[model samples]
Target chain A: MLGVLGGMGPLASAEFMRRLTLLTPAERDQDHIPAVLWSDPRVPDRTAARLGGGEDPLPALLRGIRGLEAAGCGAIAIPCNTVHGWFEAMQAATPLPILHIVDAAAAELARLGVPRGRIGVMGTAGTLAMRLYQQRLEGRGYECLVPTETEMARLVTPGIAEVKANRVAEAHAPLAESARALAARGARAVVLGCTEIPLGIAAGPPLPFPVCDTIDALARAAIGWARGA
Target chain B: MLGVLGGMGPLASAEFMRRLTLLTPAERDQDHIPAVLWSDPRVPDRTAARLGGGEDPLPALLRGIRGLEAAGCGAIAIPCNTVHGWFEAMQAATPLPILHIVDAAAAELARLGVPRGRIGVMGTAGTLAMRLYQQRLEGRGYECLVPTETEMARLVTPGIAEVKANRVAEAHAPLAESARALAARGARAVVLGCTEIPLGIAAGPPLPFPVCDTIDALARAAIGWARGA
Candidate 1:
């Protein structure tokens, strides 16, 4: 069975689970995939930890991974993008296979056969600072386009905050603007690197480029792993 | 930490987690509750088993409960109402404290100062046949009002099926009609006995009586237990 280490933000964790159900080809309950989720919302902030402004989330994340491991989970999926910065440490801490979210997104981009040019990425300030997506995708011969430091500080960060605060309606404008900015910079397609951004901009107005939801890619990959595909 | 054994229907499980975030008085991620959720959608059908038409869900439930116990969860919460029919068995299977969903709903009624004449209960056929909510609430001196046999077979059961099929919008009408029927029979307040019922009827038209969501009550109780309150 697969394990989900989540609640970096609770809604995203929930959405990921919902997506798993939708993605499964099950008519009855027993036909669907089996998963154990450690949704410890009390884990320290990922972005804050990355920026060296808060407690490191590694200890809490380890606790969750260990919990899943003890539960006999064979694989682990962490839904948050920023937390992937600590993916190597988390992976080394446990024997179970850990599915990286950025890798899932990058793989999705590759699967789409998009040319290796500018790919838009939007997420927490820490994600950008840590170059999580850029690092992952650039290795795959893709250039990453991100919001300007001013745009990120002013628009993207607050937009993510709005989603975390459950103000999803208020988040749409800023997130749309950020996506537009990335598209204006010649982005071929936008990768919603952060979990919360998808909650706001999932299906509203159409953007100039296709959208790649990391959660969707991760969920599909986790399902594939759970099903031993 | 609390262990949530869920995915009787995946969406209900997700809703329960979302409710945990909303009920908690936290401004940041670290301030919210910590929980391990085992959302094994592959668990045998609770309602079908109770009706003697499917595989018994007890072994799977025990496996999940044992998993939580091994993971060091101090207490457990199962979001599905029908599963509570096996509450005693589950509690005995694991040494961990198992919080009963019906008991939480009953406690919420008492806390709200609602008189004990007629409490409408709507859930799966097995939940109603097993008289899960009826027995629990009646023991607390509250009369339990259920849908008629025809209503249960026709409106209530199909509505629940619609929700499990992820047709929540189509579920609204039949569930609302069921609520009206219960209200017509002198139901003081409706206990959305099943988790899916609330997801369908939570928004739409206002019901004749105040609706008490068992999932909400269970979430609050689980949070209290987790926090040592």
Candidate 2:
């Protein structure tokens, strides 16, 4: 069984489950992956905690991890990218193989036939500050492109805010504009590093260049694990 | 937190989760209801068990209920219809309020303003044989319409099987045909008693007759409980 540690924002997590179902090549209900979604909205904000502006979310994150482990899950997937900032600590706390969002994105980049050119990584300030995608993808031989501070302040941050508020339609233009900025900067492909960003991008028209959605990427990873298990 | 006792057909339960978030009126992430989904497909088939053809699923159902209670869920929603055949035992085993799919459908009927007419009930053989919806809705001043055994074997049954197999597109024609047959027999509205039926119906073009989806109805009930609590 797969455990989804979610509700970093509720809708993104729900969309993850939906995508997980659609992406699985199942012939019957029994053939589909069995999952337990520990969706507690009370977990403190992952970005705020990482930025030193709020209470630590590690305890709550650990609680969800323990709960899923107790529920008999073999492995776990966290849909929210910002939460991956605590990946090492949470993974240490649980014996379950907690899938790394950045690793999944790296695999997706390879799957899309994207090579060592500049790759745009879009996500929360915490993810950027901690160098979640940049460090890993750079080590994997891909140069990373990120939003400028001005762009983050005016576009990327608030666009994510809109998605979290369930006003997904309103989030599209700003998010798309930020991605367009990356594409103009000569990015090979932009990764929707945040789970909510994919929902936002999907609300509007398509992006002109290739974009990797970590939500779908993570779902694919979980499905791969389920199929193999 | 709301508890979803699901996986009686994994896709149906996942759709219930998707609808739960979409149906909730929220401005921010926290405004959406907190939910824990226990989607274990290993529970023996409900219809087979009720027909005395398989192992009783009561133990597994009870286990899921207990797990949700331990996880701090206040109320529970079981999306699958045939499982409600054991609703009494399950409810008796747990103090938490288990939302009834039939009651939700009945409320949806009132909400849709379909009052005191012949209502069609479509579901698995266990649900129809047990008269789950008919007994309750008929007691509330509505006559019940049901598909004949011929219709069940040829149309409704096969259609539901298609949905369970995740070939939702293939399920549409036969399920819609069964509903049309009911409408022709003077049913005022058709009730999609089984959770899988709605998925099948929605996959096809819109039905000309009024039909109630128990999955959405159940989600609404769960949302209402979360709000009021």
Candidate 3:
């Protein structure tokens, strides 16, 4: 069975599960894949941890990973994009196959035949700072573009915050503006690197460039892995 | 930490977690209650099993409960209302505190101070057949009203099935009709005894009397227990 190591923000985790269900080919409950979710929201903030200003989320993340493994999960997926900053560490710590959100996004980009230049990335400060998307996509011969520091600080971060606070409607304008800015900067396609950004942007107007939601990518990857196994 | 014995229908389980997060007063992740969710959608159909034509869900339910207990959850909450038909048996097999969904609904009824007679109940055929809501509320001095056999077969059952099939919008009309019928039959308040009912009915016209959502009531009860502990 697959496991979800979640609750980076509870709603995102919940949304991921909902997407997983919607993506599965099932007519009844039994036809769907089984999953174990360890939703311990107490894990410290990923942005704070990555910035060296708050408690590290590693210990809590490891605890959740172990809990899912103990429940007999054969593979695991962490839905939060920012937490993918510690992808290598989490992978080394667990023998089980770990589905990386960034890798999934990169794979999706390749599958969609998004050209190898100027792919936009939008997410939390921690995700951009760690170069999670850049490192993964660049190694695949793609250049990544991100919102300006001012936009990240003023628009992207607050947009994600609004979603976490359950004010999804309020987050749309800023997120749309940021997406527009990234596309105007010559980004061929934009990756919604944060989970909350998808929810906010989904309710708003459509973007000019192709948008890839990491949450959907990760959920699709997990479903494919589970179904294949 | 609380353990969620879920995936009796996966979306309902996800909704319960979403509600748990929303009901909590936490401004940050750490202040919210921690939960371990085993969303094994492969569990045999509760309605089919209880009716004696399908595989029993007891073994799977027991396994989920034990998995959570092994993970160090102090109490367990099963989000599905129909599963409470086996609450006593589940509680007897495990030492962990098991939160009862019906009791939570009854408590909400009392808290709302609705006069104790002719409370309408709508849910899966199995939950009504077992009198899961009736016994608990009747003990507290409230009479129960369920859809007539024709209504159950024609409107209520199909409406619930539609929601489970993710056709929530289509379920609205039939469910609203059921609620109106119950109210016209002298039901002072209608208890959405099934978790799916709330999702289906939310989009429909407002009911004539007060509506009690068992899923929300159960989530509130679980949060209260987790927080108080």
Candidate 4:
């Protein structure tokens, strides 16, 4: 069974589960991969941790990891982007191999061999501010482009929040503008780091560039791992 | 932290969480109830057990209960309807208190001074077929009314399947009709015995009679228990 470490925003947890189900190629219910989601909203805010305003989310993340492990999950995945900043700490907390969203997206980009291509990274303010994805991708030899400070405040953060609040329509105009700008920068694919961004994309129309939905990528990877095992 | 045994269906689990947030009188995030939801859709079919054609769900249910107990859940709540038919076995499997949905609803009725009033139950065909809620409510000194066999086949059975498929609107018309019939027969309140029943109710407006949304009742009871402790 695929175990999800979630509840960064309850909506994202739901989104991750939906993506997992849709990706599974099951003729019968039992044929589908079994999944256990530990959505602990009490986890200290990932953004707060990045901003140095709260305790590290490592403890809560580990709690989720251990919960899934105890539930007999062979492997685990954390859906939240900002939370993945504590990926190493969370990894150290549990023995279960966690499929990292950032790593999955990076692996996809690497596999594509998109040399010198502008890769867009969209996520929470903390995720972008920390340059977690940018740092990771740069190490993998990819040019990562993120939303500007003003755009981050105007577009990505609220877009994520709107989806969480089930107000996807409200996020469209700004998210489209963000996507358009990223595409204009010679971007090959926009990485939706925050899990909620996919909900916005689904609720809105198609994007300008190929949208590499990180959450979807993680879910697909999880499905692959579960099936392979 | 409160651990939720969920994903009997994703929507049902999300609805239960939403009701939990609404019922809490917290003005700040910290004041709100802290919860951990472990939503596993992999458990063997609850209905299939009663119908005698599936693997036992006891192992899977106990797996979740043990997971929650390890995760330090103060209490546990399962939002599935048919699964409760194995309530005795589940209780035996876990040392933790698995909050009983039927008992919660019956107690609410008793507290409302309608101890002996007629309580209408609307659930899947499997739930009604097992007579789980009927027996439990009667044992608690309440009269329970379930749908006719024909109604169960045409309305409730298909209704449960639709909700699992996330096609809840299809179940609304039939459920509202059933609710109205029970109300006419002097049912003080209708107990949405199936977790999916709330999905049908949420799709439309409220039923004409008092409707005790089972998922909502479970969350409320969870919050009270948490606070009292």
Q: Which candidate is the best by TM-score?
A: 3
Q: Candidate 4 DockQ category?
A: incorrect
TM-score of each: 0.92, 0.94, 0.95, 0.78
> For candidate 2, what is the DockQ-based docking class?
medium
By lDDT, the better pick of 1 and 2 is: 2
Order the candidates by lDDT, highest first. 2, 3, 1, 4
By DockQ, who's the top model here? 3
lDDT, candidate 3, at A203: 75
On residues A1-229, what C-alpha lDDT tens digit does candidate 4 reach at each position?
7788776766667667766765666533455566677767678877877886778777767767777887788888888888878878777877888887887887655555654467888888888878888877886677888888888888887787666555667877777778778878878888878877876777677875678777778877888798788
Candidate 2 residue-wise lDDT, A53-152, digit = tens? 7988899889888889888899999999998888889988989999898888888888888967788989999899999887777776899989999999
Tens-digit lDDT string for candidate 2 (B124-213)? 988998989887788889998999999999999899888877788999999999999999999889999999999999987898878999
Those runs of model 3 whose alpha carbons end farther than 4 Å from true positions after fitting are: A110-115, A203-205, B111-115, B203-208
Docking class of 1: medium
lDDT (Cα, tens digit) per residue for candidate 4, span B14-131: 6676666556665323455666666777778878777867788888778777778887878888877778888888788777777888877776666555677687888876688888
Q: Please report the TM-score between candidate 4 and the true structure.
A: 0.78
Tens digit of per-residue lDDT, candidate 3, span A70-109:
9999999998999988888899999999998987887777
Over the stretch A1-229, how does candidate 1's per-residue lDDT look in tens digits? 8899988888788889888877877656667677888888888888888787899889989988888888888899988999999989988888888999987887777666674788899989899999998887897788999999898988899988877776778888889899988988888888999988988886367665787888888998898887774
- Alpha carbon lDDT at B97, candidate 1: 82
Q: Which ranges in model 4 have alpha carbons more than 4 Å from their true place?
A: A22-29, A92-94, A103-119, A136-143, A158-190, A197-213, B7-11, B14-34, B40-42, B51-56, B92-95, B103-119, B136-143, B165-190, B200-211
Off by over 4 Å in 1: A110-116, A202-209, B110-115, B203-208
TM-score of 3: 0.95
Worst 10 residues of 4 chain B by lDDT: B25-34
